[model samples]
Target chain A: MSRLSRFLKDNGISVVFGVGFLLSLIGQAFAGRAEFNEELQSDGARPVGFFEYVATSHFAVDITENWQSEYLQFFLFLFGTVWLLQRGSPESKEMHKAGLESDKDQRVGPHAREDSPRWAAVGGLRQTLYSRSLGIVMLTAFLGSWLAQSISGAAALSEERLRGLQEPVPWASYLLSADFWSRTLQNWQSELLAVGSMAIFAVYLRQRGSPESKPVGASHDATGIEG
Target chain B: MRTIARLAVLTLVVGVPLTGCAVPQDRLEAVRKATERFATLHTAGDFRAACALLTSAAREEAVHNGGPTCAQALADAELPEPGAIRSTDVYGRQARVELATDTYFLTSFPGGWRISAAGCTPREGRPYRCLLKGD
Candidate 1:
């Protein structure tokens, strides 16, 4: 295989998901544009084209709201596993290994192996930062997306209000509105439920070939064991 | 982490709404001009000219197919005396122009802005009560 082919083969799952994301986003833009135009027509406004709809806050809010929740789910999962444990699930560390493990166990600082990342072998802030980079990045993405949602959300709402000949609410005031919390919590609840259910389900369930599950024949009480 | 998160949110909160809205100045001026013309024509008792400035839906509301013609209906409805145009706010393809005595709601068409509602007065928290409206 060529170098590019080797790289694609090495990251097959990410490549597939990346392609899927693009396809779904394009699909969303088309569907969203149609729906948006229908709404505009009802309001006695002119129908916007596809490109115009894509630039609208209605589209931005829809995209960012989902992105924020997904990022929050991953951020919580990554950060939670350090201190929280589910004894019989591969999704968690062993009960005895709960909380940030010893530096030696984590192979950080003086205990890092020769091939370990340079930051992992260093001490001080760099080591601390590299250690929690995944969770930090995920959390940051969640906050940024949520903020974007709020900005676009305020604009979209204002557009609706304008259609009705009502004055637009200020962005600061919109943050306190029921609509803001409603959108945020609606997505958060579903994600939290899914992760919570998965954690508990993996305690007893088994999948033979998947790394996300323990060996089918492994003891049901086994923890932190992959197929 | 907290600082970064707060900064990201703060940047967007203060920045996006202010900078994101880029309504074309020409479109806004067009809306304002259309609103003033509707008011001007109505004030001059040029109901035929005024009827031309109304949206198709608003014209229908005025005539209702079974009613008198649009110009005749406007001559009889006794809509408020439209005062001088004050301000025009255009959001997307819709606009609301505040006049000295009334509010006019308009929608942008290929031809230009056309009044969908005219001689509208505030009704507390409810939608404006207009002498003429589309829906």
Candidate 2:
């Protein structure tokens, strides 16, 4: 196959999700703008334009709150998998091979093969850093988005207060407010539930060709047996 | 590897420069001017001109409560006396201007900041009680 075809085939999943993310985000912008304008109309304010509405705290808070939760979900899942195990779920490590495994299994230091990553072959701080980079990045993204959510959420709440002729709370005060926690915990619980459900469901479920699930014929008790 | 790329995104939004994008220099002036004009007109008993400085909702509320016309409603509402403008808080399309004796809530219409409510007093743990409020 040609290089472009190979690249497309190899990266199809990432590409599909990336495209979907953009499309959905664009859809959200349009939908959010409509609702925002309706709100403005009810408040006797002039309707905002597309780009204008996008820059509003209202829109920023909505997007960041969701982003933070997603990152938190991914981060927790990635980090949790290291020492976590589920007997028959592909989402978990094999019960017997849990807890970071042996050095040879991870191919670091002297056990690194020729095809191994440079950090894995060099083996030290770089190796350790490379090994945990995915989880670290996810954790960082979760924290960053959570920070963004708080900032924007406070601003949005303040705007709402001003609109309602109530005083705007300071950001520090808003940190302790129910609105912030509700936005956070609501998204978190849903994501946690989704990951929790997926992990357990894979134990009894069979997706014949999907790596996420065990083979159709695989025993329900077979741990971490992927397609 | 793309730290700069991520930083740019964060600066633009992840850290959200969306709210209180305080273009304070000109927008504050506009808010102050609209508010001061409303106060001056109301004090001068030019209720017609004062009524023009209100949001459509506020105007409608006035017309509904005490009107045959908006000016007559304003004349009847007997909102508290406006004092000198103290401070203005502008957030996106909304603003809250604190005057010496009263507080006013405004919204940025295409025509500029218009009073949505005036003669507002804070009530702890609740929305402000405004003498002249939008519907």
Of the candidates shown, which would achieve the greatest TM-score relative to the real structure? 2
Model 1, TM vs. native: 0.82
RMSD of each: 4.7, 3.0
Q: State candidate 2's DockQ.
A: 0.42
Q: Quick one: best DockQ, which candidate?
A: 2
Instruction: Spell out the clash pairs found in candidate 1.
Output: none
In TM-score terms, candidate 2 sits at 0.86
> Lowest-lDDT window of 10 residues in candidate 2 chain A?
A39-48
Error of 1 at B36 (Å): 3.7
Instruction: Look at candidate 2 and tell me the lDDT of residue B133.
Output: 88
Give the DockQ-based CAPRI class for model 2: acceptable
What is the model-wide C-alpha lDDT for candidate 2? 0.85
lDDT of 1: 0.83
Expressed as tens digits, the lDDT of each residue in B5-85 for candidate 2 is 577556644346445333558998999999999999998899999999998889999999889999999988787788888
